[model samples]
Target: MTFKPFAAPTALLALGACVGRQSVLDPAGRDANTLLTLFAVMLAGLIVLWLAVNGMMLFFNKISTRHYDESTARKLIVGGGIVLPTLVIAALLAWGLSIMPDQRAPGDGLRIKVTGEQWWWRVEYWPEGAATPIVAANEIRLPVDARTEFNLTSAYVIHSFWIPALGGKMDMFPGRETMISLEPTEAGTFRGQCAEFCGASHAQMAFDVVTLPQDDFDVWLAAEAAPAMATDGAQAQRGAEVFLAEGCGACHAVRGTEAVGQVGPDLTHVGSRKSLGAGVLEPTIANIADWIAHTDDLKPEVEMPAYTDMPEDDLMALATYLKGLK
Candidate 1:
């Protein structure tokens, strides 16, 4: 009979772990699981304490007719209020602090750099014995069951990078570097977003995270490190002209080509990215056309200019060319 009141609330809390995509309750990595464990321990302790106090109060009220000595009340106050609370808090603090250092990356693990920008994420993979890091934007791919270190930074304003299912939130500040390491336990896809309020399109800034086997991850890194593919058809060649004529080269870059602008994300492998505009839309030709024609309509205050003035055929060619870069 006494346990009935806790049934519904406990059920709901247990069900919270099944939430898909971005739930902290559904932790998938070691670091996040450790946090979830700590939360559960604290919750159980508090609930037991609360029930004990309430039961004592009810017992006292019913025994009001009996002789109640001041010495008993003094003993109860000292034991419950001071000693009990101090011991519980000290134990909880010690457990939580022990989980902190477990999230650090190993000394020789793979390294990746993430730079937070106004409405996008600049991603780079540092492979073994490579002259330059493989660059991508708005997405990260990691090998499952292997430690991966992340060097987080920001170019413009302060931004917080977070993937709730994976681990903790870390701040990215200009001119300073912070680090967080994560090792996914299984192969799957997840979503990441900026936790800080940076600017007008702060809500729109997001990225995709993918985990794969070790062998698959190595193959992907090799492909990403290669030069951008040359256009294969006349239509694509013509589209390259449109990209240059629209002054897109002034801010964006495509590797192995003359379009070298460091201000925007690298489009060397744009066609293969899962989502566009920092995970706002699906990567498709029609969506690409819409994004190019109405850049500000989709993402307000973005630095990219609108290309509504472009000819429909030229726009199609440009879209096809960009899509083929994968």
Candidate 2:
């Protein structure tokens, strides 16, 4: 009886989880809408088939008293047991396969190359016929209504790229590249995750998906292509010195600065990112400092070493500078 009081709210809460930034049911693009439609159609068809079968059983056992002759029973068994199920299954299969080509359609001039690493994403944007790519990490931005193609590969083990609100999942393999195109119809922020289990921190590997108006997306990309903003503040200057002294440049890159290492994520415009540590922590000053001090504690088995011995003031200064890279 006590469970009855909470059942409605609990059910509602579960249903609420099905329609959010990361949910397939709450589609924000054409491919996702198609998937939702196919799922709904199949579910409805199966429900009707289930009721028919059970209803026939109910009629035979409880409602009907007269027994049918052999000929009539055989007809019922053939039509209901075999023919109906076959037709329903075939129709659903055909409809499902027919949408594949559209899902793999070519893009509209923009190509994004994403390389999956141990637990992070390396993202590059290449405009049509461009000689150079604009590199970013752990974030993807797209222009709404324009189909952008993704060239996906992995640096190590396998990883599956999936943005539930936008489209289907694609598997990324090392030494091989795969392609998928997604056209976002809605202008909003969403989330993407590595759908495959790669390593110890597989669950922590997530990325931000942002869809913007075409003009706004162009402005953002242009800014992203430029070098990092100059370090102006006194604290930022000291943080830059600390970054150099600590040999952080050997693994990270801050364009227009001495730190030009590319073994890890590019830090050219890291300050503008929404999250830090490959979406493991928020981009707050305290959180950044904490991540720098305790990388392993926050995200286990990561390649980057923790700066546990750094002085408190220097740690805070570095975090501040990183937070101001925008």
Candidate 3:
């Protein structure tokens, strides 16, 4: 039996996944656009050089040896092989380096700090001229056409922060801060993940990134800054009681409620998020209940303890209550 190479088809499938979301090539930010342009230039240069070399090789193979001379050899060797490549490489290097510093966020822009933990992310925003920081988790929001600075660090192991639609990845190290900046030019929702493998759940450690217009972003920030909404329905009240009684409050916080635990993702506005469990599943009542009952099934090797012993009705009530948090 003959074996077929799977590389080409696999590559094609991966390329197909590059356009809709999490694609650096389909850039929505200034930095990603610059990088994409550079990549295109380099790829074009490579194709040109490959064609030129192959064409020359084919020509030489077909030519008679009698026309060859020392001078011709010297010209081809020294000029075509050495001088041209040297100048081309030097120019490309200079051009590439010059564009790198442009990725830095300008002096006047939004500042946010991201701390990567074991399988999750903690996000804090420092608004302009504000004394206190706005804390959130798992999702990030950006303003269109506004420069945003990210201060990255890790609470445990090293993790990489990356939003392919926005910019390049930067490592978050313990006790040291790394920075990167980007300005989104469009309004859309993108996906991001912990580019570094921190633990067993690394593949599931994802986040949603939403970019909006300036006025919309301001409104969102203001709403997120406020306290959590109160539960009204009797079922939601029962769920809240179950949430506290089940000891879920020790690791999560739903602002304005008894669930003021900081060890896990903030649930203050969890219901408003586009996805749940760090993008592992959709934000729905059933999924939330499943996550509570079997987090390891949805995301293997997660640190969250499963509530498999809880009754189905209680789980449903809890999920309903959490969903109403928005």
Please list the residue runs of candidate 3 whose C-alpha ends up more than 4 Å from where it truly belongs after superposition: 1-16
Candidate with top TM-score is: 2
* TM per candidate: 0.91, 0.95, 0.91
Which has the greatest lDDT?
2
Error of 2 at 316 (Å): 1.3
**All models: lDDT?**
0.85, 0.92, 0.87
- Please give, for residues 1-326, the per-residue lDDT of candidate 3 as tens digits: 77779978998998887896699879999889999999988787777666766766667777644576889978877776677767777877898998999776563457999999888889999987888888898999999988998888999899999999888889999999988888989999998988888888899999999999999999999999887775589888899999999999999998888778989999998889999988888999999999999988878777789999999989999999999887
Q: What does each candidate score in C-alpha RMSD?
A: 3.0, 1.9, 3.4
Position 155, candidate 2: lDDT: 97
82-165 per-residue lDDT for model 2 (tens digits)? 898898889988988998777789999999999999789999999999998999999999999999999999999999999999
User: Once superposed on the true structure, which residue ranges of model 1 sit more than 4 Å away at CA?
Assistant: 1-17, 62-67, 128-131
Candidate 2 backbone collisions, by pair: none
